[model samples]
Target chain A: MRKLALICVVMVLAFLPPPLLGEVDSALLQDSVTVDLPEPPAPPGNVTATDNPNDNGRAIRVTWELSADDTTGMKNVIGYRINRAEARDAADSLWTEASDILPSGTTEFIHSGDGEEDGPDYFAKNYDFYYRVHALTADTFSVSAVVGPVQAKDNWYNTGVTFVLLFVALFIILTVTFVRIARKGKELYIRPLAGIEAVDEAIGRATEMGKPTLYILGLGSAADIATIASFAILSRVAKKVAEYQTPLLVPCYEPFVMTVAQDTVRAAYMDAGRPDDYDEDSVYFVTSSQFAYVAGVMGTMIREKPATNFYLGMFHAESLLLAETGAMIGSIQIAGTDQIAQLPFFVVACDYTLIGEELYAASVYLSREPVLLGTIKAQDWAKAVVVGTILAGLLARLLVDLDFIKTVFEVSV
Target chain B: MKRQIPMMILSTIGTIFVLAYFSPGLEELEKGGSIFFDVVACFAFFLGGSNLVRVHIQKIARHNPGWGYSIVTLFGFGLMLFIGLFKLGNPLGIAGAPTEPGSWFQIIFQYCVAPLSATMYSLLAFFVASASYRAFRAKNTEATILLVAAFIILLGRTQLGLVMTSWVPDWLSIAQIPNLAVFIMTSPNLAGQRAIMIGIALGVVSMSLRLILGIERSYLGSDS
Candidate 1:
């Protein structure tokens, strides 16, 4: 029985992956990296250790020296970390580490309460604080000589920061829940998005001028949200063109998007009672290479001289080039993209520009889909919650700064 | 029937992913949703690649005007695919990953693919300069404001802004063009960006809801 058990154990051990060894040497090394820090400097410039402005007698600010040897060249200085300790009993003591890292060659740092009253360096009524600094290098660590055995000051919020944190968390949770519930049946009213609103008129103008409408979908595949949104808007626009018996041409960079666009445009045509007018060849693939696609699009635009150009989907720098050429041709150019970096370019050259989220919203507004309306409403509620948080944070800062409320939270700096 | 089932699946999966963001205890579901999307996208690549090859092959067979370029494209595509798939010239042989160092696949990617992509991105530099020159003209009040803002931002990004405005006193620092530009971006520009972002979020929510509820079915390639 013992031999069988041993054999089974060996088999399991042999099959186990490297990570299951319970000896994560890499992680252990990374975790222990905190040991490497510079030595703490001596207290400097009127070290008036007193009660914290808001808390009870627990926290103190320790300002440090302009250490001359703190130069990085003479010694490879990584950073400085502050640590505090308090005495618990005649034989026992406790120490707690800080979270923040300050760069070397800095003159001052603030050391505060570790939240334990009876721990190391803490007296019955006053807390005695001791501090040490650690120095760090690429692979080595050194600790400074201990400082303090000094009384600590306390603040009020040093005890109550937890409640404040909890309140903020609860508020976010409630707001999000309320928003989701509210959105289920609510009607969201969105203002007319110009890029979407112009679709019909642009197509109408093209039809009247006996010119085809040119539409180019960028490099994004069908699964990209921007591409999906673009296709949704395209379907609406294509339907309008179909109803007016206007020609619509689509050039796509990604083959998946091209296939989807073909289907979408064909469906739109059919829904408009113009299934016969649907031309499969009108929706075709361009090059997959970014610039190659751009070149193909520019060539098409120049040759076709389409009266209205619709540049939609996720565009990059080619946004400006396409918009500029469209502007040069005096096409009723409308462009929409979610890329914030490319927005300014489109805004500059396009006749009507859909900036950022407007491209996403354009689809909902044009389609009037109920679920979209509800989701918009929910998003509004979420925004309201965000606004509330900002307001609350500001209010808390003001109150804390003014000492209107004693800082009871024990988080000391 | 052909598109309806796929559209339904798309709508269902899309909505589930959105709901998984906030709905209780669906972390794994969200991960699965992401994996689902990746699978779809991965499969879709075959479609894209096949289409590209088919188009070029047809063009070459037809002896089209761009047939030579098409042939080059086909050869390039085939070579890349073969090298990557077979792990050719890899230090670890066929068992080695394609992107591993010292692999022929890695060489082609580093030398050919990465440089070409970077070159394409670099074209943005020349395009931006040209676009700015053409677009930044004083035609109206709005245009004039835009032009001035553009100049300040452009100058601020370069070292000349500091050189030009470094003489301003500390009290009048806000009036310095560089500081002013920074303030405008951090304040007004950030505010505008935030507002647009909010709107976009709302729009996304609405779009997602429609997709989930099957209210927007036109993408299904049929109304019925």
Candidate 2:
């Protein structure tokens, strides 16, 4: 009877639930008591979305203030996540994750769509999009209020460049006013460049020695500004050479330059009333390769032993090579280039060096036209304005802690 | 008519480009102009190549001075052109890139042209020495200053500056040779360079305006 009773009790005990069993073990019962979990981070505030300015459209810039709980109170927030949707009242399922995970303290996200016309990720230009930022803890998230219905579209004009536009307009007005003033028969004073003075002397020396004057147009294309400026100088030089009846050798690195140079020499000869003396073969095309051109010029320098060498236009590493070779041959070297890095080499190796703007000024000095002289005067005035502005800005910053002058000149583009 | 047409075109295009900077819509005009220039330049290469051949051939035929060098130039030019055009030794066959690795053209360019270019470039070392010797003669006050600056810069680039200034105090560290060299470069030299750059920028702006307004016409030769 007792054994049967004990078996019945064991069967009843086996049918009991786990919680009832935990009552037998105090440690298990204590472990079963629920403990409160950490709260999710506070939602970020002042969320805003706008079309990204100065872009080709298809992008929105989302910005928000960081969450309060992100930096203080528990400081459990790890990062933030950005989400976007096409509909304003979109459900959580409809919201697409724009950013995977941004570190805490981040307040901006550029939600850009693929630039493709047709694609799954394509955000069509001029389309309205809504954005939300989620402040995240280890396991919980608190989302910000929906920012917008912001439409992304291209701007016809970038407002950020307003200051630059104003400055440019001012310059244009100043230049035109000065140009008109000079056209009224006012003689604009242009400081003489030593390089310009040397050009005539070099040509005269070449004529006296009865040796050719070698002129290298450098390795720039005809479209290059330096090369274009050089053409003006070359015309003047060719005219002088023609008047003196001295041989002029021009080795061009580009065919277009060669053609232009040929035409320039021919015209200069005609202008000098010595068209019969102009040789078509004098200004000829050399190999377009930089080093090959250098090699050819070096060979010419060695063989021809020119009395004067004129290194002008845009020169690169070969600047010193040519200048050194000319110096070695005991020829007077005159060089002019806009390349600043090559200036030191030319200054060291050549008898005369046209430093930076001096090249352009030398061209103007050679042309001696009223219009060109007017431009130089305008340029000088503009430079004066720039210098005054810079000095004023510096003094203001140093003395009064004012930055408005600096801000005025700050170019956005 | 010739001068007027060219001037009108230059003014129109220059104005368009300047306006394009402010208007994104007209940006394509700038790009299109650049593309047109590039295409024209590409076409000009044919003229350049032909002229090279013509000039060299004339020299060779007439037995002119340095005619032997003309033969070498022609042979090299012709051989390279033939190898590149035919895509000889190109693993991917005729349509492959002429400069593809393992190709005859690539081999020749890598082995011959590149080395020759480097050799020529290396000559600048010797040239710099010669130029420096002449320029740093200390003939005038400015030349003396330049010579001293160059010497300091040279010392700063070597271990000698560090060894010489190793005993300098922390307070006067900037007066040390290396530090002074750096100051000269970063402060005075940089200021001078910036000043020059500003002048160059202004010059470019003025020159561009003159070109656009048809005031600067020497670029168009005697027609202007």
Candidate 3:
């Protein structure tokens, strides 16, 4: 009994000492905790803030030398924290954290703002700002000397895109020179496209078959280059349709495109002396939802089975579906698009395909205008220049391991 | 005068937009122009909707071929419009957005429109197979090369490719189906796409110049 009592007392002594002497033990624990605390990382140096160039006056670029401990000394820096003066001429000591704490090794940060005067993220333009760099460790930080009084502002020129400017200028000069040359009655030879030749043939066949000619301006907006090009082609086709006294159906994907098509058709009919025959119902709007549009168009194709189908404009995945449907219905499909991915699908299903630049050239070819021809010539010349540069760049890389030529072609945007 | 005014507007706006590319601090102007276009397109949406209704109603009145589809289209359009505007069956009531949970608008889209759209999109799978079949037919030298490349690609996508080429030595790994497929795609295919892209870029530039200079006016249906 005495031994059991002794064991019980021993257990109580092992577990109950801290609670019995809690006040005295707390002081000792605090002292030990203070001794193990982490030291602050060394301060970074040479901090600077400057106006970011080639942008609206909304951001300041802050940079600093790396903390000594980060690379060579204690290696304790987890990251660097950036703080900016909240207002113009605000004291450096009174600052707001600019962004998320930058991870270690980055020595620069673009302190951007929301570009609004009232928003929480706003950093006012033409406002003076100061910055401080804090080398951070797990539990403490060492602040660098303040540096700034930098004002955010904009630059007139974006030097990063200087190469782009040079190319654009060259193109403009070339285009102007060729256009002037064209105006002087100089003949420019443009290789004939099979698709352009087939347009008349397709229309004639549709006329003979006594069926409608379906002209889809595609799903592009009225402003799209391909859609604009198609408008020219459609005008010519509408005139021919009027001459032949044949039906021409134009189902549009966009409302504005439909309006434009209606105008072009009416004008063509007027030109052909068949203004009274022009029906406003001929050009109508369809839905804009992608697959729904496809479903609607497919229904028309299956029902109408138009003798000739002309799909000319910007298309997407629906290109294959539409072309394949046209093919199944045994329609003579003449397709044109600058979309490279859809080109293969069109080439496969359509009787004739206008690949890439051919779509743009189609309208010009039909119009046969000197000014438009000049632009085509300019395009060819530009393509030649691009090809020549690529060749030269390749040769330089292959021969002397020179990458200098490529740097000239590297556009910022 | 009709053509001249539009051309002038086109050239002036086009020039300013082009200038914005090379100049700083003009981004706000571009953004404003983009917003203007969005507002115009938003208005155009009503034009499209009204036209849709008018066309379908005409079809029904005339009892045209496929008049049944016109009824279906009109019903779907009207029902969706009513449901969306009223926010009927919305879990959060009228205060919530039209697309909120349990709304009839969401339900119909989830059940009807989306599935119908998917059905149309799924047709592409069968269409692609058919297209590939025709595209891969060995009719000529180019077709033969395409067939070979396509065969390699199909094989590479499966585990059988690794097993089939396992006997080949590591030094000749370039000849392996997977590696060959990747090489064809990244090198030859990319090169062709880039070439086409370059041509397209020049075409866009040329076409834009013509429009901006008012050298082409057929799109406006003008003879002069």
Candidate with top DockQ is 3
Task: Go through the candidates in order and give the clash count of each.
Answer: 42, 0, 0
Q: Candidate 2 residues B46-98, lDDT tens each?
A: 88888889988998999977889999999999999999889999988898999
- DockQ for model 2 equals 0.50
How would you encode candidate 2's per-residue C-alpha lDDT over A1-413 as one tens digit per residue? 96576556556656888677755545433433322345778899999999887655667899999988888876888899999998989988999999889999899998877545667767777877889999999888899999889988866786667876887787888888877887898888878888898888999999999999999988888877788778888889999999999999999999989988888888788878998999888988988889888999999889889999988899999999999999999999999888989999999999999988877777788878887787788788888988997898889889998767677766664
Relative to the real complex, the DockQ score for model 1 comes to 0.25
The better candidate by DockQ, 2 or 3, is 3
lDDT of 3 by residue, A111-228 (tens): 8885656788887888777888899988889998878688889666788798778877889888888889999999989888888998889989999999899999998997798998
What overall lDDT, based on C-alpha atoms, would model 1 receive against the true structure? Answer: 0.69
Q: How well does chain B match by TM-score in each candidate?
A: 0.90, 0.96, 0.94
Worst 10 residues of 3 chain A by lDDT: A23-32
The CAPRI quality class of candidate 1 comes to acceptable
For each candidate in the order shown, give its overall lDDT on alpha carbons: 0.69, 0.85, 0.85
Question: Candidate 3, residues B69-95: lDDT per residue as tens digits?
Answer: 999999989998998888899998889
Measured on C-alpha atoms, candidate 3 has an lDDT of 0.85
